[model samples]
Target: MTILLFGVTKDIIGSSTLSMPSSSEFGSKRSKTVKELKEYLGKMYPELKKLSSLAVAVNNSYANDDTIIDNFDEIALIPPVSGG
Candidate 1:
């Protein structure tokens, strides 16, 4: 799966896009839900866990923790944005 990163997420991940292998290819370490994805990422990049709030988008719509994800889905990591 390919995840699009924005704002601080991009900075933390050190890239605008992150590619992850499918569960079949990655054995059992692949993320199958939004919650798992968050945990997976947090472990790989602990800085992500420091954010006050992190939002996830799947196929352009907001997704909850239980939201199921697949290799073909379009995912994005949107960090908090503060401005006047």
Candidate 2:
């Protein structure tokens, strides 16, 4: 699966896009939830954990931690933003 990173997330992750094995390719033994994916990303890129707030989106809609993700699904990572 590929994750599109935005804002500071892209800087933290060092790229605007990240690719990882999907649950299907990795098998059911791996986690498929957004929460687990967060954990996985945290481990893979510790800088991601330093963010004050992070948002997960699936299919263009905001998704919660418990949302299940599939290999073919569209996912994006949103970082906090500030504007006047």
lDDT of 1: 0.90
- Top-lDDT structure, candidate number: 1
Give the per-residue lDDT of model 1 (tens digit) for 15-50.
999998664333265447898889889989999999
Candidate 1: residue 27 Cα off by (Å): 6.2
Candidate 2 lDDT: 0.85
Q: What is the lDDT of residue 27 in candidate 2?
A: 31
Over 1-84, each residue of candidate 2 has an lDDT whose tens digit, in order, gives 899999989988788899885443333655488888888888888998998989999999999999998877899999888999
For model 1, state the Cα shift of residue 64 in Å: 0.4
lDDT of 2 at 18: 90
TM-score of each: 0.90, 0.87
**Candidate 1, superposed: residue stretches over 4 Å from native:** 23-31
Candidates in order have lDDT scores of 0.90, 0.85
